[model samples]
Each structure stands twice: as C-alpha cells, then as structure tokens.
Target: MKNARTFTTFALIALASTATALPFDAIDATQAYQNEVAILEATGAMPSTEPVAIFPAMPEEEVAAPVIASLQDVSLPAQPRVGAPAAVGVATQGREVAAPSADIALPAVDLAALAETHDALAVRKGEDGEADAMMMLSDVLFSFGDDRLEPAAVALLEDLAPELEGATALQIAGHTDAIGDEASNQELGLRRANAVRDWLIANSALSADVVTATGIGEVDPVADNLRADGSDNPEGRALNRRVEFLLPDAG
Candidate 1:
C-alpha cells in the first residue's frame, strides 16, 4: 500500500511538470512526460511552489487608434464676376481708337416707316386738288450711267404687275442727277420713262394709250446733290436719278 501511494504521487508531479514545460499544442506529449519523469527521478522531488510564467503567446490581431490629418492655410487672388466691364485698347487702321461708352444712347430709326412717309408726301395732285398714290424707283435699279433697264428693274416691273391689275390710267415720269447737262438729261429721262411705260404695257394688263411717259430732268430732288463742302453727293445723286409712277386722280 505504501509503494503504490508513492508511485501515484510521482506520476501526478511528472504530469504537472510536463504540462508547464510543454504547451497545450505540443506535438509529442508522451515524450515531454518522459523527459519530466527522468528529471523527477534524478532530482528525487521538485519544490511545491506556484508555477512560473513561461513563453508568452501572441494574439491573432492588433488594434491601433485612428489619426486625422490637419489642413494648411492658403491665399488666392480675386476673380472677376460675369457682365463686368473690362477695358481693352483696340488698334484700327494704324490708329488707336477709344471704345464707345456703354452708357451712351443712340437715336432709334425705322427705315421702312420713313420711306413710306417720303413717298406719301411726293404724291401728284390733280387740278381739283385731289391726289393719287405714287411710287419712286431708284435709278440704281437700271444700268449704270444709261437709260436701258437692268434685269432687276425688269423684275421690279414684273412684281408691280399685280398692283396694276385694276388701274385704267397710269403716268410714268423720270428724273436725273445734277451731274449731267439739262438738255441731255431731259432726253435720257424721257427715254427711261418711255422704256418703263412700254414694259408695263407689254408684260402687265395696262393699255399703251392709258400710260403717258414724261421727263422732269433734275428739276425735283429728294436729296441734296452736293454735300456741305460742295462735294458731289453720291447718295443724293442716286436718289435723284429715279423713275416716278403716278396714278392720276379721277376727273
């Protein structure tokens, strides 16, 4: 009974020593126990003190605190807003010109209305003070420096065919610029008027007897033939050289 008890005590001490020497995941637990048994036999007995810490095990994962970055202070230049006026110098024809001010107001003009008003004032009046509507065709519509009709002039007469549908009596008159002699200008004017009258009779519904052709030369002008400095006014001359169509008032 005494030998059995001694063997049991040595076996339990060897197990405790093996468990402390080797880890729980040791590959050869039997070999470690054997080693412990041999040490026990040699030393006879170990001191019964508390077990000391051995190899420290590492954890699976490590945690760290998050760090935030700080922003730096920066300076930027100012930018222009939309619709802001920016001054810029412009070169025109070898000369530097100042741009027109945005604040300046220009007078408004209606060209179509002005033309209608001018034609209305030039209407021919009858002997009894009654007047009829008149149309003025610029000389530019005809060939340059001649009485012969241009293609555009012929087209213009064709367009007027609709307006002459109900007209029974028509009078055609022509004028010239101040640049030419009176006698020659009058003859040229009469020829132009006759050309217009003949065209209307042939192409339109108007009768030859109903249309009378005449010439007033440069006696009447809608614009000045000369400029303020006595220079020839091309615009005024152009306006003066024109054919006038008149519908005489009923007798």
Candidate 2:
C-alpha cells in the first residue's frame, strides 16, 4: 500500500506542472490581443467612447425693424381746387403761368338770332335817322368781283318785294372790302347798287324815279380790314363787303 501511494503522488505533480504551463500560454494570448487594440487606437480605426450626434445645431436669425416716411418731408406745388376761381399769374415750379381770361365781352348783336328772324336777313335801325328801316344784304348774294346777282339773291328779292308796299322812296347803297383800288371798288359798288335798283323796278311795284342807287365804296367799313397782327382779316372783310337798303317810314 505505501508503494501505490508514492506513484500517485508523482502523477499529481506532473499534472500540476502541465496545468501551470497552459496558464502561461493563455497569458501570452491575452497580451497579443491587448497589443492589437493599442495599434488600432493609434491608427484612429477604433470608435470613441462618447456617442456622436447625427445633426448639428442651427444658429438663430436676426430681424431688422422697418423704416417709416413722413409727409412733411415731401415737396409739391399748391394747385387750384375743384370749382375754384382761376387765379391769374399762378406760381408753379418758380415760374409764372397766365390763366385764361374769363370775363370776355360778347358781341352786341346776335347775327344768328337775326338770321332766324327773316330768310337770313339782318335788319337794324339806320344811323343818324338816315332812314327808318335799314336792311343788310349778305355779299354772298353776288358773285366774287362781279356785280351780277345769284339765283339765290333773285329768290330772296322776290320774297322781299311784297314787304315794300307802303314805302315812299327806296335807297340802295353798296359797299366793298379793301381788296381792289379805290376807283375800281367805287365802280363795282355803283354797278352792284344799280343792279339791285333795276331788279326792284322791273319785278316790283316800285318806279325807277323812286329808287336811287349809290356807291359808298370801302370808305365806310363796318368791320376792321386788318387784324391786330397786321394780317388780313377775312371775316371782317367779308362783313364789310355788303349792300344795304334804306327805306323811309311807311306813311
């Protein structure tokens, strides 16, 4: 029994040595794993201990205040209001502007009203009591630069023949504008006056002795021959070229 116990003790010591050698090999493997971890950390291949955020924080935006304007800083001209009277020499942008005249004088006689009274005939009182009734004849009744009367004139005179029933005497005066020489104008006026007188004696109840024809020429003009700018006034000249009939009061 002693010999058997000695063999068992020798076997236990050998097994203990084998187990201690295995622990040493395991320690070497642990040191190799630690070295690999140190190399990866130095090369920046290993992840950090703290967790990283996926999104970054944003900065706040600053807001500016709005600016306001005042009406007193603006400059403008003062204008006339609605339905206000117009002022003369109004100041505008350091300049003077003249306003139109409002109080314009109108003509004393309304020719339109007279035309409507009788077949375009304008009748008025004779000046200085030369005659009781004075009738004006438009120059349009005669041709231009001629003493011959137009058909329209004949028709007008036919209508007027009946109105001169109780007249004792009839006087026809012809006037011309300042278009020709004084001698030519005088002759033309006399011829025009004679034409009217002859027509009245032939077509009406008036005798030749009772009718007298005269030529006043351009000396007695009823309108201005020239305008304010020295230009020929066609309208005024047309008004002056006319014939007038003077009749005494029917007694």
Candidate 3:
C-alpha cells in the first residue's frame, strides 16, 4: 500500500511539470513571431499601421490684369461749304451817271496765285462773305500713317502763316482715306489735326484760343474710296486724305 501511494504522487508531479513546460514553449514562439513582424516593418517589407501623412497642396498663383490706353477727347467743327460760285464784279445797271469825278481803279485779286503761293490745293471764298474761307492741304504734307508734318510741309506752312496774321479764328480739320477701320481712322485724323494745330500755334501768330482742331475722319471724303468694280482707288484715296484750314475774316 505505501509503495502504490508513492507511485501515484510521482505520476502527478511529472504531469504538472510537463504542462508548465508546454506553456513556456508556446510563450517563446509567440514572442519570436512578434519580433519577426517588427523587423519586417522596420525593413519596409511590411506596411505600417500608423496613418499615412498627406502632403499639403500648393497655393495657386494670381493672374495680373491687362493695361489699356486712354484716348483724348476731341470735338468736330463746323462743316465747310462743298461747292460755291466765285464772286464777280457787278456792273452798274441803268446808271447813266458818267459824271463820276475820278475813275476808281481797283486792284484785281488773283486767287490762283494766292493758292499756289500758300501751297494749297484750292482756296475758296465763303458764299456768305461772313463765313470762314476754306483752304485744302494735301496729305503729302505728312508721311504715310504718320501725324508729323514733313520738312516741306513746315516750309509751306511758313509761307501760309502770313495769311493767318489777322485772322480772328482758325479751324483745322483732318480727313483720312478709307483704308483702315473707322475708329483708327478717326484717331489718326484727330492726331493729324492736332499736329497741324500745334504747329500753327507755335510757328504762326495765331493764338490758342482762336485756333481749333477737329477730325473729320473718312466721313468727309472729297473723292470715291472704291471704284465701280469695288477695287481700291489710290488717286481718289489720296485726294480724300487731306487737311483743311478754315480761317475767318479779320475783325
């Protein structure tokens, strides 16, 4: 009976030892698995549990606005008479008064000579005699697509300045051909008229208050801009591109 009891005690102790050893082995295996997983993560062989950090978006750039040019204010002047008859000396009708004490001799006025001397295309007297006289100047006075007066034009203006010495008022009107847009042509005409006006005021005896500049643009063309077949007419266009000077009689 004593030996049997001792054998039973020994069997129980061995079973407890075996159970404790099995639990230690299982804990070692779990620790090794955790270490391997940590190595894989550090070496970039496995993905991380931490949320991926996002990059901030770049700021957008701002755009700049465009610049625009400012134009000057210009006003139109009085329109000139297109066609008018020349003044002729009237003969005394039904006047038999031959008792005139002394024969009055008047100097004949030569308009053609006056126009040529002033370098003007034509000089026309006003119909009402009280209106302003019109003098037409060709576009040859300025370069193509330019507002500046040529050297020859300056010389011509110098000759013409004498006529404006006693003028009460002067109007400079610029006209352009129909080769460009109306707005551009209008601006060009205004620039041309301003150029002429500036020259006259600076070089001539005319005052700024008495001188006025205007742009007629292509609206007051003296000739056709296009032919019957819709082709361009260089000659007519040249004629249309002109500057007119209107001078009122001296007070």
Stretches of candidate 2 off by over 4 Å are 1-116, 124-133, 248-251
- Provide the lowest-lDDT 10-residue window in model 2: 49-58
Better of 1 and 2 by lDDT: 2
Per residue, candidate 3 scores C-alpha lDDT tens digits across 1-251 of: 45644554474346434644564543454454456446555655545432112112224575567855454444333364566433333347845333343334333323334566644466544556532334455566888889989888888778777666555677888889998899888888889989988998999777899889988888977779999999989988987788877653332
Which regions of candidate 3 fall more than 4 Å away from where they truly are? 1-113, 118-120, 124-138, 248-251
Model 3 steric clash pairs: none
User: CA lDDT, every prediction?
Assistant: 0.64, 0.67, 0.66
Sort the candidates on TM-score, descending order.
Answer: 3, 2, 1
TM-score of each: 0.47, 0.49, 0.50
| Clashing pairs in model 1, backbone N/Cα/C closer than 3 A | none
lDDT of 1 by residue, 1-251 (tens): 45654774676667656665655643355445456556655565543322222222335476576755444433233364588754444768978666676555333222222235443224433456644335455554567568778887777667666565455567788888887788888888898899888888888767888888998788877679999999989988877878777655333
